[model samples]
Target chain A: MPYAIEVTDVKKTFSGKQEVRALDGVSFNVEEGTVFGLLGPNGSGKTTAVRILTTILNADSGSALVLGHDVAKQADLVRSLIGLAGQYAAVDENLTGRENLTMVGRLNHLPKSYVAGRAKELLEQFDLADSGNRTLKTYSGGMRRRLDLAAALVARPTVLFLDEPTTGLDPQSRNDMWEVIESLVGEGTTVLLTTQYLEEADRLANTLSVLDHGRVIAEGTPAQLKSDLGATVLEVGLHDNDDVARTASVLNAIGPHAPNISGRVVEVTVDNGPVDAMEALRSLDQAGITPTTFTLREPSLDDAFLALTGHRTEDGDGEDGSAAKGSGGAGDRAGQPESATVPVGGNR
Target chain B: MTTTISIPTVTGAPLATGVGARVRWAISDTLTVTKRNLIAITRIPEALFFSTVQPIMFVLLFRYVFGGAIHPGHGINYVNYLMPGIFVQTVAFGAIQTSIGLAEDLQKGLIERFRALPMARSAVLAGRTTADLCRNVMVVIVMTGVGFLVGYRPTTGVLPYLAGTGLILLFAYALSWGFALIGLSAPNSETAQVMSFPLLFPLTFASSAFVPLADMPSWLRGFATYQPVSVVVTACRSLMLGGPTSHWVVQAVAWTVGLLIVLPPFAVWRYRTRT
Candidate 1:
């Protein structure tokens, strides 16, 4: 398959009171008709990279191509083929959902004859037809997001850029968003997804690049990244944040690798999943340190993410970190990376 | 709200990619975007309400309250003199909204959505100034209606009055581009408003908008008379009252053209390079 988007050694440094190298020689390729995930914890330059690829933010050096057109030189050509749903919905709160989507079509110079029909069709597809006439402020978070996604499809763009599509959504909404994204992929639209959630990337992306400090730490298919992590995860969930360190020490006795504590859970990479999990829990039970829940699952992108960022997948947020969703199976790990700003948030 | 959408029978052919096609797209795209801004004004009733109310309030307060005390000349009819100046000032005041609107769009990341599209980069600015022009026209008409209610009459014929309205709109349109730079440069909507006020406040107050420049101190008179705001006010006053009409009209036109020439590139440059 042909590549729809490609970036080579892209660099963008923002100057303020201090200089922030938002992207330092970042490179990636998104094949056509496939979802490519740019995974990062926070401020990892994923959003910046998406901005550059979308031609909203120019790179300090290096070139980006969308559908074979150079982003900086042939920006209009690239823009015509791609649609962007930003970190924020970017819809006018005063305008109704139908108006918002139609405006996007108008901006693209889509035929006035077909634009309104397309907006309605998209609203219906996104399950927002009944609410299409309501102002965005009146819509729920999920409804607004559905409208934003619908607006991006106003012109039926060949390539789509979705930046953290499910950041603030509840699980049901997030799953609905995932289903919507999956359906779009079925229609052969290439997607460049930037997200902080490991499960979101695993569930939707065909391949993903893990970014840290403005560089790609690793890149592979979901299974490849997990297997490449080369470890089995012992996830121990406890009652509260206070129980993390105590649980970590208990898991350390059975696992060969150091236990990584993110908020309330202690994750350890062990030699054998079945034998080590039982031994660790037994030790914990004897010590009277009963885990609220424990599961032995295959390594997930979260473990790889932790390995790359060198921080617990705790999202660095003190409040919701303890409540991070638990991923019981190897296929899906529930960790939503909070919206992280680069130590210096710039160009956004 | 649920009207049936017309099925498009005309799915037009793709035009050949050339300079002519690009130019055509620019025009159509700009009008489309302008339509969006104009439609938004209707939906946000408060924005329209406040925009019209401020100028009417100024007309009422100045006509009834300040009219007896402020004299332009013995027979000049302070309401007539004041109405033209008010029209000019109101149009200029319209620039602040341009900046505030653009600033809000940028702050909310709406401009990024615009920039990401294949549309002309200049469309956003063009649509905004065009919308402001439309708004200034309505405000001027409402203000003129209010002027009549308060006994302000223009002695000039229909042609001169039309010319006066055109000049004020042109000047306001140019001023909107200048304010657009302030809007694009501002970090947020509140900052955009605060930043524009200090700059525009002096232009309106220190000029011949509300009172005669002759009453001002000599030190302030030079700026009050020579400034663009003053020149437009002077041109508009002459057009409305059939007063001396030597170079003020030409000078006002020149000032507007000068603003148009200088400010657009700066605003476009800022929009293109803001990141």
Candidate 2:
């Protein structure tokens, strides 16, 4: 089946006194009816890429196709087939929830009856029935975000682009949004989401692309990216900070690969599993280095991102030594060992 | 109060056929926005109180305080002469609200939502301008009622009175396009207010609104005489106070037509650039 979204060598340069290249020949494809994720840190060109795909911003070069329509040439048709919830909540505060949805439906050229009926259905579906008559200003942050999402889906778009939909929300609200997103994809709505939350991407996206600067550094299923790092990650917390280097050398003798020291904790990836874990512990015992804690488990997406990007996911800065972290899960463990590290964060 | 009960029912089914469907959709959407504005005005008593009461206060101050010193010996009562100019002034003042409204809408990201929709781009502006024109009509009615209570009467016949009122409404509507352009282009509400003041204050004061332009110094008079506000005020006064109406009436109509041609496109261009 043809992909729902295809971006080929797309480049966008925002021109001013100082020109910023927002997208540098970025390319990717999202299969139809799949939850695709553009995973990156802040200012990693995720929003710019979504803007280009939505046909809101014209690319300086390259091409993007959505739902078999060229984004540049057939922008209107592309827009009609997709729903977009921008980074910020864009609902009109002066309007009631019902009015906001109806207005968007009317703008989409739906029949007035269909607009009203669809608005009613959406209001109930989004748990906004009781507050449908209230002006949006009176709504809580979560309600407004939900209403914004409902307005985007009023046209029943086949492709939905959500840019950081859950940012700044409380934990409960974020979970609620995740549920709504899951149900949307359950009904076969193809979704492309950009987020800073590693868990959000790991929970929602079937296929994830780790974007840095303006290019895709790694792409695979969550488990595939993680297991590709090896069988298990032995994370050992040290009792003394001075024991980290000594512990690393001891684990290296058993595991072949050197252990990575993060503060008081030492971590090593090994394929031999518990046998390797026993051998490393015996070596440490013989060296008289008593550790604080030790755990051997499957690697996480954070580990995969660190192995690929050489940086943690949670680290705000994408420069040297900041491996993106958080969202530890093991789902599909397939490996693609092509290590190419581009510039961490360009203007785009 | 008569309490009449009617069953609530939904009307107007959505139809998917027609090339002009988006235009109709835009008109309806615009009406919804207008209704929301009206509801907001009603809910906030201060908005209605100020809109209705402010012009009446201006009429009272000018007719009682400045009436004697600035009288032109054109055989017309100063209040009668001032009534028409007040109508233009109130309507022009009323147009500023559109700018403030647009600026607020932009700040709230409502305009961005409209842009992303499949609706016609021109429809948003068209709907807003139409709603504002209706608001101008309401202000004209209220000001006309207050003018009568203050001993100001239109000496001209009903046709000329209607024509003059129409002229004021058209001029105000056209002026609103310029204000809407400012609202769309300005970076924020404070900048929009600052940007609007230079044009707004000069246009109101330099014209024949509060005083006769002939009484001004030669250079000032030359500038004030051809001002669009002056042409509109002169024509409206001619029709209301029974004067030679031929020349000023033509000038007022020409100014209105010219503005209608110029400002809408300029507003659209500015909107396109900003978005």
Q: Give the best candidate by lDDT.
A: 1
Q: Lowest summed-lDDT stretch of 10 residues in model 2 chain B?
A: B4-13
RMSD for each model, in Å, please?
7.6, 8.2
Q: For candidate 2, give the lDDT.
A: 0.77
Q: Candidate 1 at residue B91, lDDT?
A: 82
Q: Using Cα atoms with residue i matched to residue i, what is each candidate's TM-score against the true structure?
A: 0.87, 0.82
Candidate 2 residue lDDT tens string, A1-348:
789999888886655443445567788889999999887766556877887777766787898999878988876667677888865788877678998898788777666787899899999999999999999889999999999999999888889999888987999999999999999999999999998765787789988787765668867765555445677889889989889999999888875556788999999888788899899889989999998898997766567567666655554343111111111111121353434633222211
lDDT of 2 at A203: 89
The residue-by-residue lDDT of candidate 1 on A1-348, one tens digit each, is 788888899897766544556777888889989999988765567777888888888888998998889999988777877888966888888788988988888777767767888887998899998998888889999888888888888877889999889988999999999999999999889999988877788799998888765677677787666554544888899997767777888888774577887678888877677888789978888878878888888666567666555544434422111111111111112353332323211221
lDDT per residue for candidate 1 within B194-225, as digits (tens), equals 99988888999899999999999999999999
Q: How well docked is model 1, in DockQ terms? A: 0.38
